[model samples]
Target: MQACELNVIKYILFVFNLIFAISGIGLIVAGACVLSEVGEFSHFIEGRLLAPPVVLIIVGCIVFLVASLGCYGAIRESYTMLMAYAVCLLIILIAELSIGIAAAVYKGDFDSAMKNIMKDSLHSYNESRTDRLAWDNIQSKLKCCGVTGPKDWPSKTRPLSCCHPIREGAAPPQEFHCQDAIEGDQILYNDGCFDELKMKAESSANVLMGVGIGIAFVEVVGILLACWLASAIKNKE
Candidate 1:
């Protein structure tokens, strides 16, 4: 390549590195948001479900490291730095793609996993304090009763969280008590939480997938640019 052409490529790589850095920040932010969003109801989600977001976060950090190094190599016209950047970016690309695929696979099974975990949480609601709090938080936020319906709770102690939000802190009124009264007479089991919580989980998972793909795209481009620049530097040398 001509000197002018190599200089043009160098400048392009430099600017691309800046954008790549910003993208790294974006990845970390998006990943954390998704992680926290789904993590709130972690009790109902299998531990493995958190892997996608966490891995994305790591990918973002790696992007920062290699991307900054890429800028150094590209701007200084250093063949060695450019080669190193290309190699690191190639590795990062593979990891990002792997995590993206894992996320896609996990998303397909997220619903059933959540449902099973929720059922287990429900069963432990009476025994585990953490489970009780999780159930209460989810029920109150989503305005849901048991996993399927109000009948899913223990008959004697359904708890007040399953009731209306307005009556959440207050004692249940005579007209809408949560006791083992006829279904028509009580207000606790009005809705099931499975659909609502599952939707939230699925949305978060989708975001994770999108971010993963985005990071992967950036890495691929970075790898290409680094390799091209490295070759140009070598030819010039």
Candidate 2:
């Protein structure tokens, strides 16, 4: 390639590196937010469930380091470094694709685990204060009743957390029966915690999947650019 054409490629690679750096920071933030959101329910779930966000964070950090190396390689016009950058991008591309596939495929396992956890928690609700509090918090926040419904509670009556229009410092509306009510009242939330939790887990996984795959595409472009630049520099030499 001509000198002017080579310069143009270098310029484009520099800009691409800058953008990739920003995207690295974005991935870090996204991963942290997702981790925080899902981590709230950590008490009820296993540690492996947190893998997606953690992997995202690791990938983001890798992206930062790679982007810096890419910038340095572009500035130095080092054919060797450019080739190394391309290899790094290829490795990242593989990782991102794996993460995306895992995120997409893991929801079924997540839902099954959620069901078992919720049921076990419900069975021990009266025996454990921690479980009781957790159930209350989950029902109130998710606008759900028991594992499957309010009837899923060990006792005939559901807790106040199942009531609609959850009050912070005060009681709910006088019309709705909150505590120790007959199942026939129909005042408790109808939705099941199982469904809600499954939906939320699936949603988070989808976000991770989408982000991983999208960045993987961008990394493909970077790999191409780096390889092209490396080849052109070799020719120019």
- Best candidate according to TM-score: 2
lDDT of each: 0.82, 0.82
TM per prediction: 0.88, 0.89
- In model 2, which range of ten residues has the least summed lDDT? 175-184
For candidate 1, write residues 47-86 as lDDT tens digits.
8887778877888898888789988988899998898888
| Candidate 1 residue 161 C-alpha distance from true site, Å | 1.0
Q: For candidate 2, what is the total of clashing residue pairs?
A: 0
Candidate 2, 104-175: lDDT as tens digits = 587578667878988898888778999988988888888888887777875544677887774598655553
Lowest lDDT sum, 10 consecutive residues, model 1, at 172-181
Error of 2 at 61 (Å): 1.1
What stretches of model 2 exceed 4 Å from their correct place? 165-186
